[model samples]
Target: MSKSIDYGNMMHRAMRGLIAEVLEDVGANGLPGEHHFFITFDTRHPDVEMADWLFDRYPSEMTIVVQHWFDNLIVGSDGFQITLNFGDTPEPLAIPFDAIRTFVDPSVEFGLRFENQDGEEDDAEVVDLPDLDLAEALDLDKVEDPKPETASDDPAPAKDADVVSLDAFRKT
Candidate 1:
């Protein structure tokens, strides 16, 4: 006789439970100190909307940092609404829980990543990030790209780009 276990099913249920807990706390006004969310989600989901460029630019996953300037965060049984400061503009967004692709709290190292329950047209994409130096953070204007390394007589070795895996992680 053979018995089997399905970790995928287990993981899916666990993630669902975690989301419910967070929403419950939000409803009760029990969000702990300095614990805002960095939510990355699908722009094309039925419940999400933005300027058309948002879908064209980040059709799969777009991360929004919700720390300093976010406001009007209201929770409901089906979804939530919040206001985000996009540069000089204040944009109000209403998002269903189903639209969430990822949630991370850099302050506590807590993170949650969600998969598209329905089929996805495109695989997720992550772009190259510039080094978070003070100079780059302060400069809102464009900066020139660094020149490619030139070959020396010693013939230095080349390097490849890195791939960050989202697997092996779950919200704590």
Candidate 2:
């Protein structure tokens, strides 16, 4: 029998490490410039800690925005803790790194998605992130459109922007 390398698991570890490093920096110096994050994690994870109300509301998975009003960000080797406002109610949550499903920073059009490979039934639904006007978010008057073929005299819509995928780096 031949042994095969587990590239998928390796990739997940590296991506999680990248997330950890970014959060660590943010925890130390605060969010720099206009960078913000939309982190989605599995609420059902055994290590996840949140208010009972929150658990009731988001029984499976929940997405939180780490933007202007977040506080008490503490990143650890296995997880992170943060306090986010829920309709003026401050709620602290502890999320293990392994529970994270997706992380996105629309300010710079960066995103990461982690898929389940353990053969467990993944009941998480596709989450639609709020559309962001990149020009307004970045305080830019005009942003160049990457697709010249579809270019028009009018400024390109933010939704028309291209998102680079990790698959691009994979060997065929």
Candidate 3:
């Protein structure tokens, strides 16, 4: 048998497309200049959580921010949530590990994406805050720094890379 499979590397490369999809959304709306995001997601995949008390809550991949008066912001591989200051009040939200859609820093042109994690295993594990803070996830300075924006005067943001073609993909 002379078959070798690099599933780990393959998964990483395949995931870049997913990340691109999320960034596309940011360019469309979130990019207003020097604005960033505090995206929280599930490291486990699939099993995302929200407040059981809210009726409007829907199980989806969501991304929040710390652009304004956000406090107690936390980031982990699985998911993230924070107390966004809306006017004079603050609310604490805890999102499931899998429900993160994307995190965009429009100030530069950098972002990342994640597919919803499947939370098949519900185990209690305390995650630690990494040394590299969320602010450095990619690089705000690189956000919205791409040159194509200057080339065209179109106000509308760029769209995500089409998956129908391999033109946007690269082999790992």
Q: Which model scores highest in TM-score?
A: 2
The candidate 1 region of ten consecutive residues with least summed lDDT is 159-168
lDDT of each structure?
Answer: 0.51, 0.67, 0.38
Clashing pairs in 2: none
Higher-scoring candidate on lDDT, 2 or 3: 2
Write the candidate numbers in order of decreasing TM-score.
Answer: 2, 1, 3
Q: Which stretches in model 1 have alpha-carbon errors above 4 Å?
A: 1-14, 20-31, 116-172
Count of clashing pairs, candidate 2: 0
lDDT of 1 by residue, 1-172 (tens): 5387755556655664566567557545634667655566667778886666546755765556554444566777666776654433566777776676666554565666565434642222222223233233323132222223322222443221111223223223
* lDDT, model 2, position 164: 23
lDDT of candidate model 3 versus the reference? 0.38
lDDT string for model 3 (52-142, tens) is 4321332332334435334444544443444543222355665543344444443554444443234432212212224334344434343
Candidate 2, poorest ten consecutive residues by summed lDDT: 162-171
Select the stronger candidate by TM-score from 1 and 3.
1
Error of 1 at 118 (Å): 7.1
TM for candidate 2 is 0.69
lDDT of 2: 0.67
